[model samples]
Target: MSPQQKALLLPKKQGNFEIGSRSIPSPGAGALLVKIHSAALNPVDYKIKDLGFFVTDYPAVLGSDIAGIVEEVGEGVDNFRKGDRILAHGKFSNDFAAFQQYTLTDARFTAKASYEKIPSSESFDSAATVPLGLDTALVGLHGNHFGAGLTPPWTKSVGESKKPIVVIGGSSSVGLYAIQLARLSGFYPIITTASPSNEELVRKYGATHFFDRNLSGKEVKAAISKITDSAIGIVYDAISLPETQSVAWELLANDGTLVLTLPASVKEDEGKGRKVISTFAGPHDPQNEELCSSSWAVVEKWLSEGTIQPNKYEVLPNGLEGIIGGLERMKLGQVSGTKLVAHPQETQ
Candidate 1:
């Protein structure tokens, strides 16, 4: 009936999030109006927020990962209904952002569950964390643009290769999700690198071998070969430093596949048939749009079963007002292995 919804406003280039009144959007056909419960903060949030690369305009509402309830569904929508408990990785183009009390979501991006029976086992703060990280991981795994279709060539059987992919940053939100998804997909021998303190923590997420990144690439490669038995297959480089990408490439067995979150200095090695891949993380990819619903279904199943867990979160308790500082901190790399969550309930 009226407007004046509070949003975490991004006022200008290098600007941060803030609380400000905004209109509550009405959903069009195929879109649902969700009363936002939580907004998951991602590295990309700060990347675009501080750098001003993707803003349609200044003073934008910045959030792409969200979890909440569908308060209203637009005409022609049958996949979800009023009061359905759901979470989503919003389409970044419409900026189906959730730093506000309410936002638009296409039926495609949402995953539904009944909050009553599930008891909201994962807190709102933790729930939104999964959609982004898990979606990214799931897409990489499902694409199989990688070598041996996510299992290494040398493995005895595809079924025995859990974590066959050696993800370089296993403790990262995306990296952690990739490890779990790899485990879920029956890929064994998952290898990853992080701070030494994170070994056991990441192992719980299905990282069969957690190496210290501080080690030389030669040492890291040896560790990888030990579990994968000298057969490195698919690799997901969640943290893509140019040097790191080169290191990941070395570990790949000849004719291996390496998928980097960012494009790296990978070239066609004449003797080795390794292929390099770059993935777009959200709805932008025509490939991703088709996979969105199915992928979310897979992620939702794991969530329901408690087979995967959220990254550690520095969840802000307030709504939009509390988000500004969090975004700034994210820019400085202050939030590592911990997601910054925004609660939109107060504003809603």
Candidate 2:
């Protein structure tokens, strides 16, 4: 029998999460067996339980941001070896997800951060925050089908554009990364909306102008005009709530694109040439595979050079068990400007 590992599981659809045990699986060809050190909590993790969306299988393990050490390298992979500190995007599949102590990672999507390029100051908790948020932001802005189809910054001779871009919910995880990517893409006067208290945090992430999230649509639009005369061609609504969607829709210029982390709530104006893209951040999807893989390839360098910064994070207590309460706080909209990380190896 394979060695069993502690995992947080949802035994059935709309079921409660509980501490459970599952056999740790081995890596297949082009994969690596990772001993997960830190797994970050995402709103989707709890939504999968309460909303019963995404997962089809019972006894599902759900988590997407993973940082850990490579335990075993499978055939045909040479970039990573045993004991390498790495971070990889996790899929919904139980064997590849982040909620378990051990999970399988596809070599193509994994970032070996211990390489000479990445600074040693990066921690497992910090690295765990990058995979999902960074991918979502990258795919939304540069993905051909899943995003606004902008030119990626990683490409050579990619010059900066002075166009203005707005990122709603700027303090949220995905919004934070969108702001930074906007800066890298050469968007001028990159503006975002968040709580006034998080103004400093969002600015640190590359937002050039910040507005209070409580502003009305007209107010936000008016405020933005005072900052930059450039039309708002792109709006990334990381929160994607109905209210934020309305604000984003109102602020967007005709023929613009509104990128969302959730389903679109605002109706597109006919003949306006506006586009709404709801980005699915999973790298395993065929449509997103190429773009995400390309972004993942440069992630280590991005982190090393400080082109991309991890979200501020708080470590959850009690190891895996603490994730339950952390999810509750997220569901209640109590967490702000920080990722919540869980130490899976500390699970009892």
Provide TM-scores for the models: 0.88, 0.97
Q: What is the Å distance of residue 48 in model 1 from its true position? A: 0.4
Candidate 2: lDDT of 7?
Answer: 95
Clashing pairs in model 1, backbone N/Cα/C closer than 3 A: 161-187, 161-188, 162-187, 162-188, 163-187, 163-188, 163-189, 163-190
Q: Model 1: what TM-score?
A: 0.88
- Model 2 residue 344 lDDT score: 90
Which prediction has the highest TM-score against the true structure? Answer: 2
Deviation in Å, model 2, residue 167 alpha carbon: 0.3
lDDT by residue for model 2 (1-348), tens: 889999999999999999999999999999999999999999999888999999999899999999999999999999899999999999999999999899999998999766444355547888999999999998999999999999898785545577999999999999999998888888888899999999999998889899999999899999998988888999999999999999999999999999999999898888989999999989999999988888888988888777888888999998889999999999998999999999998887
| Residue-wise C-alpha lDDT for candidate 1, range 215-256, written one tens digit per residue | 777888876665656477678888877877877887887878
**Each candidate: what lDDT?**
0.73, 0.92
Off by over 4 Å in 2: 115-122
